[model samples]
Target: MIQMPLQDMIKKITDGAGISEQEVNDKIKQKLEQLSGLISKEGAAHIISNELGVKLIPETTGRLEIKNILMGMRDVEVVGKVTHNFGIREFKTDNREGKVANIIIADETGSIRIVCWGDQADKTSDLNPGDIVKISSGYVRSNQERNEIHMNDRSVLEKNPEGITIDIGPSAASRKKIEELAENEGNAELLGTIVQVFDPKFFEVCPECNKRAKPTESGAYSCPQHGDVTPNYSYLLTAYLDDGTGNIQAVFFRNLVESLLGKNAEEILSYKDNPSAIEQIKTDLLGNMIKVTGRVNKNTMFERLEFVVQSVDPNPNPDDELKLLEKEKQSVEAQAVTEEVQ
Candidate 1:
């Protein structure tokens, strides 16, 4: 039920009417002139959309795609492949004690996160990456400025729905500054200088399943599924990155830490027992400019935003970065206007 984005409306008009985007813009400009600037640019676009017989409202299409699942929608059904399973998270508040399951699903159009609650949350127990999923009777809500589908006890989730298949490519990361981040982003790129780097904390993961291994009563760690066995080590490195406008705490996992510090995994593990061994490396990292693209995770326990680094680029081309950021700025502005009218 949310208002369609102004750019989306313009695209609809241009594509549906088989006219150039410039022509659509020219038409909107004429409409604004006729109205003597009484209406906003977005209003003019919507008027032009209607004049060109382009419908801005979402209709009940068969098997709705994630990208078309607009905000403020209810009782919606969608089918997509499970791209990621965030597992279950339990929360206890003053009067409520419950858990929610989160998973990201993708179709050819796009991807989105779905939050499952109550009995519906149990349905995610067996979900894995690359599994087709069908969700019915769900509602979409805005969380941290992004759209997410919510499933309550009334919703139904079908795992591996028959004859349903989805072909999706990789999702693109949005480029923005640290101050522009608000945890709504799925993946974001930030170019900043490392102001500080902390010692990495290493842990054990089951070699077979890659699940975290918990310490046994005897002190040796073991995975829940694989019993007592040798485990591979993983680590997370934390650093503060400043992009002039603001700064953010960024965390890089074991795989990306090597590139982040220009060191190998074995070299990083050597410092696990001797924390001071990394001081020189840490000092070298400070003031070094790098770019990171990753998920924006809110560390509930720490009560702060942390960027989970997925990819690292020690150097980026300035001219290309400026062009991308400018395009992103326009997209952000149009989304802001859409939210306003909604």
Candidate 2:
């Protein structure tokens, strides 16, 4: 007989309703199989934690007591005040329909939005905003914005009413520097703050557009529906240093955003399906502190230096860049000192 966690049981019940005891058992079996697929490593870790009587909480939910949580995990216990809850509602789409809830929770670490489902929705409703609660088995899922964590039914909630404890960590990752990162090729890590920003403009078409836009008599440009055309410019710049044999500065352009945030780019391109959207994004990329991991190659169109950014932090902030820059400065100074001593 498998002793399933209450949170897991709640997920099984909420995911599929109006079930019988035998069905629940079957669901448990299926859940175990599914869990094996989704959480083999985490399950093993949980088993060991259980044997050791260790508690785990999601990184965003708890106080500083349980700060060592790993990344990309589920099932953490946290104690926090219920800042708010938005009840439940139907979320309809061409593909499917379901329910979702929004709640605000906070501990010493910080605050974030949490979403509840099914029974978890009801459980959330019972508690008034500002009431402190001790939540067990609360799992973290990315919010609709894909930027932060939200909770769901696979999690458990209890009204603490008193004070609750939670764990905390750095709200974001630190980024490197450009001067330090301008070395060689290979997998590089860099972090820097955005020191500059450029404006965005509109575009019509180039010779590249086989159909859409056409050239104007004034040597400007024009499109079919978009009319006498101008390109849209948007820039997003961040600083990063690649930690290869030596540090190397890295930068990303429109192509990198197309790779990392294609969905958003697609939305902008929906009306025209032209190069204007990409140009807009690039123009808007200035003064945005960024950490990029990619290669350093000479800009064929420019000078002896250029950075081809690969992946970047979609959600970056000021403090993260400051800390990373400080660390890199220290490392560089240390290396310089050593060379002088030698």
lDDT of 1 by residue, 1-342 (tens): 365577887888888889998999899999999999999878898888778888776567446878788778888799988878888888899999899999988888877899998777888989998999998989989876678999987888999978887887666887788998875356798899999888898899999988899888898889999999788888999999999999999999887998887889888898988999889988988998898999788788987888989899977777887897798889989999999997
lDDT accuracy of residue 55 in candidate 1: 74
Task: Pick the TM-score winner.
Answer: 1
Summarize candidate 2's per-residue lDDT along 1-342 as a digit string, tens digits.
Answer: 123344554344434454454554554456557666665433543443343343443226542222232234456665666656657876788997777676666666555556676666666767776677766665544432222234565567677645544443323322333554332232455554443332222334433332346667987667665666564433333333333333333455555544434445445445244545555554445444455666555443555454567677755676865785688789999999999997
State model 1's lDDT.
Answer: 0.86
Task: Flag regions of model 1 displaced more than 4 Å.
Answer: 1-63, 172-174, 180-187, 207-210, 230-233, 315-342
The pairs that clash in candidate 1 are: none
Candidate 2: C-alpha RMSD after superposition: 17.1
lDDT of each: 0.86, 0.51
Worst 10 residues of 1 by lDDT: 55-64
In order of appearance, the predictions have TM-scores of 0.71, 0.29
lDDT winner:
1
